[model samples]
Target: MNRTFKVALAAGAATVALAACTNSSTDGTPTPATNGVASQTKSSSTTSGKPSNGDDLNISRFADKPCDLIKPDQLTALGNFRPGESSSAPLGPGCSWFGVDALKDTTFFVTLVTKGDNLESMAENAKSFPIFKRTTIAGREAYSADRTDGKASCSTAVSTSAKDAIFVQGRPPANGTGTADKSCQASEKVAAIVIGNLKG
Candidate 1:
């Protein structure tokens, strides 16, 4: 369910990075850890892993290189995506899209878009989804989204800690139609792998 995210072209794209204080960790929960680059605090004080070269986590990898962690068979690329300073990766399908925004050295923002019959209609259609259950990793917060209408559907997820955050999203299609579901699901899973494989 992969598609190019056209939302990047829209003006005033909302910045959804979890690092911002304004965006509460999906659950409104708090962690007692200092925010530092490459440093992270798990929910239980467990060592998730270390970044490579004993250096702080650098999000530049994803920005600089397009790693195809998502298998071609698992999902087809609707097209190529070029992330901007404000928007990390913007890719879309015929009528759906996904992207992210980096909040800091360790945090990246995210967004998901579905084709709307019109601008106002799209906003209204997006309201049907509910915030997912929050999962805290290394004392950070995370969550996903699932929404639908008679003609379109979309979902998204965000993982965050004191040090960094990852955002993933998808939009299959209306009535379980397009690749949005698979894209959203695979993107979130790949995001976890990226975070889990961090070297710091």
Candidate 2:
């Protein structure tokens, strides 16, 4: 946790700008549900084989403890970043993790946007989000964007509802140990897990 790493996203003539972000060792197990919400015993209700709806993933229940949104086992599966470290970003309240040891360059986050714009609106505006592309994650509507300001960031904005988006972001170490696409791949995996564990 004392070591420093780098992720290269050298800035230049670009149309995008990824927000600043900034995990890997939890040997116990997946964190249990807080706020008295029961953990899901069945497969992801939010991830059924079909598409997602506005009510698919509601994180309001986790507003007090955003880190609990992800289970540690799932985090372990995704390069095991350090345990959920809650943080604040331009999007909203969120948690971040950085891989330790050999998992360097592996960094990811889950941000809850209570008042942020949805993917469609963000794309349509083109002022705040200039490079948003429609996509899907675990049957949920999503959008992907990379940091154009150079900093190496890959983000998948999941539409919890047509009006709300959950920001799942990824970035390599600043030491150039990773790339935006690869980080994004990791972020997508995390997003899928989040969706899979969402309560019905």
Candidate 3:
């Protein structure tokens, strides 16, 4: 995805973030699943809905840019790339930089995905998670557009402590030009871990 897009948060903060994880395809069809997981069917379109507004939306936990949560061992670091700071080398696929402004204060967790990763794989390797749900974020009608094995390439917007936050997720196989079916699963895993680890 070479373009940048803005998404309006429920709190009315304007975020000029990345949009359409990848470029669009002619058919907009996802490449066949060669990863031994079942392919996902297209999801029906729906009108934007209301956010949970509390249970799943929290940002206070992450506002400070906790050094403790930056686990290099768990996530391979690609280093920071501030917008407009041009470089000669190509920023490889899946390379992203999370800034202080990118993370809302109440956000206790963040999740990233590359294509071909599945939800079951994450859940199996993760700490713990709750059952999946198809819900909205910041009043945008969204759904759990994942495959049966739980593979997708999408993001999550959650609210906690009466504040709004954005959790941008990336999943792989390139998916041609759309969100991966496993993205929903990745969101679930991320949310569960973040929620479970949060302390009052």
The per-model lDDT (C-alpha) reads 0.30, 0.52, 0.30
The true-versus-predicted C-alpha distance at residue 80 of model 2, in Å, is 3.4
Residue 81 Cα positional deviation in candidate 1, in Å, after optimal superposition: 10
In model 1, which range of ten residues has the least summed lDDT?
Answer: 32-41
Best of the two (2, 3) by TM-score: 2
Q: Backbone clashes in each candidate structure, one number apiece?
A: 29, 14, 32
Candidate 2 per-residue lDDT, tens place, 1-200, comes to: 44433122112101112222100115421121111111111122222223344355677777678788788777766664666677554445777666564235466667776544454443332223333456788877776665253136666666676545566766666466565456667667778777666653
**Per-candidate TM vs. native?**
0.35, 0.64, 0.33
On a 0 to 1 TM-score scale, where does candidate 2 land against the true structure?
A: 0.64
Q: Using lDDT as the measure, which candidate wins?
A: 2
Pick by TM-score: which candidate is best? 2
- Per-residue lDDT over 1-200 for candidate 1, one digit per residue giving the tens place of the 0 to 100 score: 11233443232223222221131256533221111101111222232322323334444344433233233332234322333233432221111123322111111223221111111221222333442333443333344343332122223333332233444434332233444345445445544644554433
**Best-to-worst ranking by lDDT:** 2, 1, 3
**Candidate 1 vs 3: which has more lDDT:** 1
The count of residue-pair clashes in candidate 1 stands at 29
lDDT of 2 at 23: 6
